[model samples]
Target: MRQIPTLAPLPARLPDSVPFVGPETLERQRGAPFAARLGANENGFGPSPRAIAAMQAEAGEVWKYGDPTNHDLRAAIAAHCGVTPAHVVVGEGIDTLLGLAVRLMVAQGDRVVSSEGGYPTFDFHVTGFGGELLRVPYRDDRQDPQALVARAVEIGARMVYLCNPDNPMGGWHPPEVIEAALAALPDDILLILDEAYAEFAPALPRIDPDDPRVLRMRTFSKAHGMAGARIGWAIGAPVMIRAFDRVRNHFGVNRIAQAGALAALADTAHLDRTVAQVAAARDRIAAIARDNGLTTLPSATNFVAVDCGGDGDFARAVLTALGDRGVFVRMPWVAPQNRCIRVSCGPAGALDAFAEALPHALAMARQGASGG
Candidate 1:
């Protein structure tokens, strides 16, 4: 018998699992399309018209690869954020940039810190790079910045991950708290601040790009309503920004995405409108949850997390019942956090579907538990 090639130790040790199962996969599993697409925290408002136009204009030039340096987009992002171009590094999306950031900082067996139930993608990146993750639990449904810093210091962590207007719980810390946490962190450790949902939140005081201890990641995938476009940028000290280039895919960002991101950055009006719509949708979701005897966590992102009034298993049943009704949504992956199911902001039709299905879904879950 012929011997097969052996896998690398790191890859071999990992489980065959993805951080998220896309709705498309769920559709396949269910053998039917979901009636409401409100689970992935995507902007249902869609991309700005200006961005659509820009992508269309560039459609004919698909043959040309995007600028390897991502020059124009980086310049536009810098201007928008009041930072210099040297402070920006463009990538396919925050996910890719996160992977890059982790690779740049983590060595095998190096310790990292994050919330117990923080953004799974960041945790996935850390584990893939063989970094030991120390997860600090959320206090009162929000990431405990103080706990994170303490854990980082205790473990001598090389990196710490945070998400503002965080996913799953849709909670955030005040700017002062974030700044204090940053100040408390050890100089040797880098804080990877994922602000992918920043546009929907109140304007927070900016962290100085001169600070080498932090890397701020932002994206057009949220308030700009361009998740499919796959464009995100990182802001950091000039030296740290340049370091991403050493490991990033040279042509990772495509021509159309670059064009769309540039146009989206310039269209502040569309962004404002999208933010307003998301806010309205969030209110509608909260109202619906309240009417059904559930409660919603305050959200600064384009989604709301509805408390199912029970434990993780109860929320999981509710989530499952919603899926059976062709309404797709998600819940947190860990204990207390998993007591809520997340619903993304979307067009009126999508929310309407959610509103219609939720009561029946909850009823079904309760009935199932009561042996009805």
Candidate 2:
């Protein structure tokens, strides 16, 4: 018999889990590729032409490492935010930045606060770093900001996470509510404010950069339509920003991605156009759901959550039927919220596939319920 080395206590104790299964993995399992890809909240409109051009131009420079300091990109992000480069930290993406925040702020057994079925990746990060997670349930399908603050204080938490224009449910609170949450949070607890979908939701409020306890995360992945580029940045007080450097991968941001993200940031017209396209696609999705007798929640992000008019089992059956019919979509992992299936905005062709698939999927779900 062969012997293997043992993992450390934290890694060993943790179960093998992933935040989501990729579409490719699903295709492999089903022995077919999906006709419409809409599950992951990715922007299907794609990145700006200018950004694509910049990445193509920089393709030859892939032989060299990206700027370790991420100087120019950080400067551009700072300029956009009306802050200095010292307050910006560029990373591979918000996912990596989230992990970094967990590592730096959370020691083993420290308490962290988040929504019950919030962005699962953040929860994965917290647990991976050995932090104890306390979750507050959604109030009226939206994250209850006051409840989050109260939990943080009651538990003496080290960090709190809030996703503005949230995922899965696509619900958001007005800026004043977030401001109140910030005020209510204890001084020592850091608020990791994720604004990845901010471009699609104009009504949401942006926080002041001067606040030391708040770190706002932004991404080129959503409105800028550079998900493949894998680039994002965090804006916070200078001291908090610098702490990321201590544990972050020094050369993590690829050269081509940096070039693409910089160009994307410069092209405001492209961003505005993309946002409009997403809004239209969102409306189309809602209309299709209504046509099929399903209602949709108001969406601030690039996706809409369609209420299945049933329980979690019913929604799961609908999602499975969609998969079987070559349409890829997702749903929330927990109850009340899990009763809705999430659909991402895409080109007319993709949504057409979805529109074609929904009626058949509904039929299958209903039939299964009757034991047919």
Candidate 3:
């Protein structure tokens, strides 16, 4: 096929890669649906009934574009967070906001730092904008902010990314630890603190709304069960927050999502119930892991990482076995971390499905062990 005249030659620098493989794609490839959909860290307990009712009530508004100012939602978020509306910027999701942040801050050949085998989405955005990566290995499975900052200073990095309650591993540092990390960064290096799981973490620290050196990211996807809503925002200094307006898609947040997030925010009782359910699910996951002679990693988020007591290959075998039998858990991508399989907190029925498949997966893992 001839290249189109209107399009320039594709950049040689960007490697072909996707940040994550969706569970739906796996179901398609396996020609079967997952009995237990616990791989993606989504809240399967579901969104609040109130949020759904609100979305339904607002369904007629779909014909109109979302408010360009996002007035009411922004105001409510500001009130909840104890910050002015100027300090908030909502987007399609943290993923989209991350892309905008990377594009705004990283110049060609600029340096970015994150934990090795950390959330790949941030790394993807960095490279998509021509920034070189400086990946520091995680310290004891938790992404170490101190190490990240040292590397950032070493490389004169333009940006650093972190997930408070990190993905895959589901580990986290308290807010004070985060405060210390903020204090450690050079003034010019921007820290994109992704707090997608903040709502589920019990040890979450309080931050003064006036903090200058950090941008605390939050999303409704986890505890609020709004993964489909695609509502995420950042809390930052007014000037920093305003910078997003220069590049963000102003009308990217849809009307249904807006109603859902606002109602979800107002339903704290439902949020508490969901958190309790997640805790119970985590306990069940731990129990299952222990029964199977697997080790479960400590988690502050809504997922657990069960050590398969072997290497990446063994864990992959276990994951495949589970998927074949209709369970859909996942594993980390790099060794050491990849030695375990990650499972999200789902409905009790889903947990039962995982419990049923795990022993068989373990047996398959052992059978394949010699091949490794």
Candidate 4:
């Protein structure tokens, strides 16, 4: 046999697993299409009509590479965020941008901090870069910012990651709390704030695009309903933003995605409608949980975490039963929080399917728990 080149020392030790398994992969494994897809926290309400029109219009132009500079989109984002283009860097998605950020700051064995069971993608990036990832536990279902900062300081961590209006738990801290966390953090420690669900949040902390200590990441995937488009941006001080150009995949963002995101940004009416629909869906999800004698955690995101009144295994059993019934939903991976199942907001019909399947799924899970 021909000899093959050995993998790099860092990558050779890492597991061959992705941060998340896509719903498509799950469907392939299950050998059936799900009747409802609410597990991914995707905006099932879909992208704005204007965005769709723009993408369709740009389809013929797929022959050309997207602007290597991402100039026009960055300009639009800068105007929207009240920052100059130099302070913004566009990338394939927050996931790619997270990887770039990690590469920029995390040296081998350097300490980085994030909440236990927080956004796993960030963790993946940190580990991939051979950085030492230190995790702080969530307090009261929200990321304990104080604990995160304290741990980072204690270890002299190079970076800290926090997700606002958090995922898989759907809790949020007030603006003051976030600002206080920023104030308490040392200037040397870079904070990576993943604001993927920012659009659905009721309130947000004011952004200082000139702040060197923080990088705020936002995505078109959630609120813009452009998950498939795979576009996002990060805002930081001009110096930090400029550094990304050295390592980022310059032509990675597709032309269609750029066109779609640009149009979506301009269509404020569509965004407002989607936000309203998400709020209504959140309330409906809570009602469904109540009807099943379970409870939902308060959410400022487009998803709700419903307490299954059991432990991780029980919630997992419920999740399996839901999957068996062609309803796709997810639960937290770690305990205490794992007692809840996460349901993404969608149109009425999808929620109806979930509402229809839940009671039976709970019955099956209970029966399995009883060893029947």
Candidate 5:
């Protein structure tokens, strides 16, 4: 008898599917454009003009591959962060850096720790590499450092993941609390702090780049509004940073992206201005939520998570209603947290659409729920 044509078995620990379906995919199904793009926690304010100019000028150089060493960007980022270039390793956004972090530390079946309802990208990486995931529940919308540390200890986890200014709920733990959490972590277990929103959040707790047990990952995607550029990096002890090179796509950071990121880093004034605007927009979203009788989670990042004061069903309905109304948005993937829909900080016009849509969407969701 001939063997089955299947040449290899899928990894048991890998998820059997793609977990996140983007708003664009939904828009495609609906056959229309969204009036307000408040979903995906993106900064619609866009990248700096300096970065754009740099990218445009460098466009002619696209014929050349990027410096595989990522020398110039690394140097620029290092100087800005006050770290030595040796302590930094750039990749195709923090998502890729995270995958490298996981590969460097985790063997198949090695348990990893992250907040429940935290960033999904990290979870995707964990599953992709066949690591066992253990999620710590959030404490009042903020990712609980205490619970995460306890779980890390109990599970003998190889890695502990966190997003400082978190996604979905958009809550943050003050820096002192995070320092306390770090002190509690077992030295052998590595902490991968996802700081993609660091550019937007108020300065709080900071992890030393040279910290032996921590890897701080930041991205150009968020505050830089350079999501398409796919530029991000990790800061850690020199040896730990070096490990990423072993698994990273050496020439993955493209030339335009490198030139663009360098310019973005240089344009700190634009970053500061963007952060301030995001803060105001966050306040605006909160006001809209309140006007509609919803509670908005406190967020240091460029988004808000508005609670409809109901179950996941109601929240999902709100999400669908919002989508149907041409106001794209998202909610947490699981219970309790899923009671809220997340909205990013877009321009004022988008908020106007949201302010108008919130009441209508809620009414529609409530009516649908009543019918059932």
Candidate 6:
């Protein structure tokens, strides 16, 4: 037998599960296409026409590698956020940037703090870097910032992750609450504020880009409708932004994504239209849930979490039933919150498909729960 090199101690010990299973993977397993793709919280509305044109123009130039510095996109993002380019670092997406941020700050056995059922990718990165993740459970479906800060201080944690207008359950904290959390966090503790859904948020915490204690992440995946493009940026102190150059994949962001994102950023009208459409779709989803005698949690993101009026097992059944009917949706992995299924905002036709299937899915789920 041929000899193979041994894996590193860190990777060797890590779990073999991915943070999220893509809808494409599920479709492949089912051997059928989903009629209503409303699971991933993606902006099915899509990017601006200008953005499409820009990517199309860049298509023929895929032979060249993207700019290692990501100069133009960084400058544009800085202007948009009213910060200097020195305070910005662009990357493939928030996920990759998060991994880099984890690698930059966390070492083996370092203590990190996050919500119990918060964004799993952050937890995934923390564990990959051999950090100890201390979770504080959600209070009333919202991420308890105070609890997170308290736990971080108690553990002498090196990092804290908080997702504003949180995922799996789209609830948000106003500016004051987030400001209080930041004020409470110790200066030595780094706060990785994942604001991936910031565009749809009502009000955001006023954190200065110069604040060394916090690194704010924003993505083009949601409102910008460019999840497939895989581009996002982080705002931090100049020193922190410069540090990413040490370990980041210089050419990881492809040329087409860069062009598309740049064009998308410039089309303010299109972004405004997308946000409006998402808000309307959220209302429609809530209405659909109500019509089926279910309720939905308040949402400030591109998705709504519809309460299944049952436990995690029941919610899982509903999700599976929806999948069976060619309606793709998802649910939280942990308890309490898992009682709800997440449905993303999409075109009217897609929502119609979902609205049509949901009642039947629920009926099937209820039958299964009763062992019928």
* RMSD per model, one decimal: 0.9, 0.9, 1.5, 0.8, 1.8, 0.8
Full-model lDDT, candidate 2: 0.92
Model with the higher TM-score, candidate 2 or 5: 2
Off by over 4 Å in 1: none
Candidates in order, TM-scores: namely 0.98, 0.98, 0.96, 0.99, 0.96, 0.99
Q: Please give the clash total of every predicted structure, in order.
A: 0, 0, 1, 0, 1, 0
How well is each residue in 1-372 modelled by candidate 2, as lDDT tens digits?
Answer: 878799998988986988989999999999999999999888889999999999999999899999999999999999998999999999999999999999999999999999999999999999999999999999889888889989999989999999988887998878889999998987799999999998887676657787889999999998888887889999999999999989999999999999999999999999999889999999999999999999999989999999999999999999999999999999998889999999999999999999999999999999999899
Residue-level lDDT of model 6, residues 46-151, one tens digit each, is: 9999999999999999999999889999999999999999999999999999999999999999999999888989999999999999999999998999999999
Off by over 4 Å in 4: none
TM-score of 4: 0.99
lDDT by residue (tens digit), candidate 5, 137-166: 888778888889889999899999988888
Cα lDDT tens digits for candidate 1, 147-213: 8988999989999988887887888777898998898988899999889999887866468899999
Model 1 is weakest, by summed lDDT over 10 consecutive residues, at: 199-208
Task: Compute the lDDT of residue 187 as modeled in candidate 6.
Answer: 88
**Backbone clash pairs in model 6 (N, Cα, C under 3 Å; residues 3+ apart or in different chains), count:** 0
Q: In order, what lDDT does every prediction score?
A: 0.91, 0.92, 0.88, 0.94, 0.88, 0.95
lDDT: the better of candidates 4 and 6:
6
* Preferred candidate (TM-score higher): 1 or 5: 1
Mark the regions of model 2 whose C-alpha exceeds 4 Å error after superposition.
none
Q: Which residue runs of candidate 5 sit more than 4 Å off their true CA positions?
A: 1-13
TM-score, candidate 6, is 0.99
Q: Write the per-residue lDDT of candidate 3 for residues 129-209, one digit (tens) a residue.
A: 888988999889889988898899888999999888988798889778987877788789888888899888877667666
Model 2 worst lDDT run, 10 consecutive residues: 201-210
